[model samples]
Target chain A: MSGGGTASPRHVITGIGAVAPTGLTCADYWSAVLRGESGIRTLTRFDPSGYSATVAGEIPEYTASRYVPGRLLPQTDRMTRLALIAAEEALADAGADPSAMPPFACGAVTAASAGGFEFGQKELEALWSKGGKYVSAYQSFAWFYPVNTGQISIRHGLRGPGAAVVAEQAGGLDAIAKARRHIRSGTPLMVTGGVDGSLSPWSWLCLIRSGRMSASPDPEAAFLPFDRRAQGAVVGEGGALLVMEDAERARERGASHRYGEVAGYAATFDPRPGSGRPPGLRRAITMALADAGMAPADVDVVFADAYGVPALDAAEAEALAGVFGPRGVPVTAPKTMTGRLLAGSAPLDVATALLSIRDGVLPPTVHVASPAHEHLLDLVRDAPREQRVSSALVVSRGQGGFNSALVVRAAA
Target chain B: MAPFPTFTTKQLVDLLRECAGEDEAVDLDGDILDLAFTDLGYDSLALFNTVSRIERDYAVELPEDVVGEAGTPRQLLDLVNAGIAERV
Candidate 1:
């Protein structure tokens, strides 16, 4: 559906740069996801034999020196390094050089939850094992949640409207929404989306403690979102970054490749538990559809926020059913392959959704062969489905009652 | 006691290499004492880490301001050696 053509300048995705356990770049990631390759495995960063949620999706064949400068490596963390690579790829893909444009015409935004846990773990290890003096002074900001934005800005000379959001998984979508705001409010281009990770034992402890993580050792049985034997999430590292620019700006720069338009976005916080009010997931879905000036039928596919937990999964299913009828839309969770990337999850899903729009095929939800119980949803499983995906909805939720929904429709 | 020795350009360069990667253009073998850390491709964070290493290696306590104030290797040598001299 063409988003009201003349009302407001649309924010369109011009480029994608993503890294996950499955693939290192947007093209590779899309290929792996469509081919239904599983990247989930036992955690290898550090021995997790003693931990419950031992499985994770780690980026394959990634070498830091190859992607980031050696000087920046000492000052930055793994998350920041990954983000820098993604940002550089995105800039090149868009062909919109920041140094060539007015400083205020470009911006950067990113999201974080664990905030460089791998790096923090290293520093803390040095602190305890050795002494305080051994701690790198880079610890001051290397572990900071917003360091990705700051580092990206500095690296690319992006001097406009920098911001960072922290809402666990939902933050990815929120960060993209913020970038879209900057694009609408006169900024021509924004480096946005999230490349997040928390794969360290230190952050792993926190993730496992949340009781939302799977304790299963088997990769196939672990982190299943909707299946009967579904366990909790298998935490993963790395997400994705996207280059979103105003349609007119893209046209001017001759970077006319369009993934889709960020047509609508809405976020809601779930009321305090036991407050008697309903969960906000349903409301967020409804409002996002309304914001896009579309009805429930307008959406062709849904990228689910599939929390593998039984209760949360049920809630999300009910929300989808309330918006679309039972089995109304094709819903998939390609993340089942790479596990959930916390703050990185939604942006990865957003990138996958755009890819789905690009190639008329919907990626499958691996391992979840059948629903746990009779649910009013059509789960795409095992193999990718060939479909004409014009508009898609991406749903994401954070632990602290955060619910966010974004609508991206095929460019007119 | 003998006069407290100031850190040499070689020592600072060593610390700089440990803090960040070694830069090829910094002319480490020649005179680099007065060269600004920025010119040597050392950022504030690198300098801070270098200071931590220096404090440990020399058993000195540099002031908090040294990381920002010491732009050149010579400046860092003076501030850190001055702190060490006070103790000696």
Candidate 2:
């Protein structure tokens, strides 16, 4: 794909960081991504005893004391710990300090569907095993609501404005969308992204009850989004953080910008279970393009929200055909490598899309041997493809009827 | 896709030691929650982490609700024994 023209209202990504199965930092994650390394492994975090789902994408050998200092390690859950680590990396990468910058100018936001389930499960297990007497007091705060955003804010000393968006899978992209709005409205620097760590026994049980988990035991065979034999999506755990700043602020700071801007963001709701494909998400894509002042033809690549479910895959394909026409857009789903990070999924895609725009390379969607649907969308597989991308459209949807689209542009 | 025998108490102690990552002497007859967890310095996070390791090693799902009824070490042993029975 070649660039048609330049995109406008560029929101610069000055900092990118994450604590993921690929790696502990954005540099490590990006390198692993380029090499196409798989992080999925057997369930080692807990005994799956009677549970059917056996595999997961888990962060290997993560210790909070290594990333976060000794003092704050005990107070935060693993999910928050990952978020803080990523945020710290991003802040350091951006070379911005809230104290050095204007007061009330730096704020933070995070996307999260659930926080600290591993911690919650442990406490609950204690409660059940010991009749509440052994339930640790720390569970109250460790399992506190929106703990990721709170921990990130406290860790970074970011006090401008903080919020946690809850849209299940779309939370990450929506958080970035909100951060872009924050940067546009008033705040100079807004840190945004999402995190999830729900692989604990209780959490895993809950997800199993939700009936969305892929039952395939083999990691490679599991989570084949947009593939014919795709069962259901697998669960992965991690967090990614981005330091988004106003284009003007970014330029003034002399920060090396990766992408042009978060030009537009639009979300739609698709209520009613088992409804045919996501027309709501398709409308969201069109709306986001309109918000970015671009057309479907202007979008060079598409980071697809391939949910790995047959119904969802079909819906998204139809929606893409309707929006971008039968010619189709280049679509890639990298989450197939890490399973779905739930809330963290969309932000990772957003980051991937931004990186793609910056480097003029399309990351491949692995494990997809064939296009699951008849739709004409170009699903890049196996290897990276060269593309002169000016604008990229990233679409994401959550199971609970939430859909969102974000437009990212190449940095001039 | 693998199976292992139901763990004996000695095997469980060894597993617990390996899972817990420390040499805190466990009271096998005492409260599993308090002794194996709190009093033994294993916090909730650590306990869950240990449980996750156990589940992976055993390839079993210790039902959250099933474990809730156990408090004493004997009770936990019985719970694990029953889970292993059901799976086998």
Candidate 3:
């Protein structure tokens, strides 16, 4: 339970930065979450003439020059640009010397669902329209791959073992889990989370083919994850980076810490169609509780992954009913207001959960008229709710059938 | 979306500024690189955002390379007009 020891599972978050539909930084994002402000806006990133979903939680006022150098900005796809900004903020908040830390001891693990599709599409269109020669050399590494981790490592001099997790939406929590494992295994520090930007015509065309995008033109009605009128999810883009380090090391360094423990993590896959959750999601929650060395009764809140799609929402509700067993744990899906961040979504939810623990308040799920299911969990709605949150569970499931759950505890 | 036509430099400047969501202070002939996309005072996200706006307002699907090629207002105008001509 201490640093400098060879055997300890303690991982403390030293700093955090998030570029969400809510806001650009942790504080601003958290504040917007409380106010129930929706970042969903009309499609300005790409024309939606032929698309089914024309709304998203687009990050407004994002300029690479504002965060990254103009010269390097052109080389980086929008995804990496967002990641770098979040990483820069997290590193500064941690006060870790990117230069001073042992390059091998400081590591990074981040996740992405769609990768750099916007940039990839630009290059792909050029190739399609003007032949292969028109494709930018940058496209070789920028699009649809897990290069955000590599890009962050290169830009920040983090030479430690870097990794990219591709678990779809749950990839965000999965990346944090991986970072915690590295820290436990003696990596001094790790920058971890999810970042992505895929709201482009190329990406949209693929999403439309999948038949999961919301078709409603009304912004409020477009992404109703747990509502009677719910159609499907709204695609969003952004990134969140948390500077995680050994708790003892953080204290020894007199570093300012945000939250206490990652506590628990579990992942599952529900591959079979119409099987609901394939029993894996419930098992994942149970495993996460066990990993936290706590019982389901110990959790103070549940951040549910209300997928908006009727069938998936039912599966999640069933999973919750089986695990929590009528405990009526207060649950919320603030992402309803901002649209889902895909790979970046769940980590932002985790961040919101952590901030809720810190602030002793719960954010509301905007626009859900009534609980979508009769599971009757205490769902926060319309406005922020005051609560004593000691520990919470955040859950998410990806499009290609990946499910993940994590337990986070407040600093004791 | 309206079809674009050959425009004078003043009209080109206005079109570029409108697409960029900025005012007329933008240099119509200056190096676009030196003018940080922000310095041009375009709304953040407008670098790519203006492409969508230009396409809609001018009814032209500009080439993706336009971001790299449209350094001056004249270039943007030329690109739009050329696309319009092709469509016509």
TM-score of each: 0.93, 0.79, 0.80
lDDT of each: 0.86, 0.76, 0.77
Candidate 1 residue lDDT tens string, A42-123: 8787899888878899876577787887678788887788889888888887787889999687898899987888888999
lDDT of candidate 3 over A136-227, digit per residue (tens): 54566777466888878877888887998998788989999999889888888899988776777888888778788888878887887667
What ranking of all candidate models by TM-score puts the best one first?
1, 3, 2
- Give DockQ for candidates 1 onward, in order: 0.53, 0.03, 0.04
| Total residue pair clashes for candidate 3 | 1
Q: In model 1, how large is the Cα lDDT of residue B12?
A: 76
Q: Write the per-residue lDDT of candidate 2 for residues A1-412, one digit (tens) a residue.
A: 1121334233578887776787888878776777777787778888875888888888887656667754355456788788888888888888877678766888888888777888888878777875554454457677865787787776677888899899888888888988877766678888898877788887898888878788988888878888998888888888688888877778887886555678778999985767655358778888888887787888898888888888888888888888988646888887777878889888887777777877788888888886676456778887888878788888899877899998888765
lDDT of 2 by residue, B35-82 (tens): 434555444454554455556566567867533444434556666767
List of chain B TM-scores, one per candidate: 0.86, 0.60, 0.56
- Judged by DockQ, which candidate is best? 1
**How does model 3 fare in lDDT?**
0.77
Task: List candidate 3 stretches off by more than 4 Å.
Answer: A1-6, A274-277, B1-88
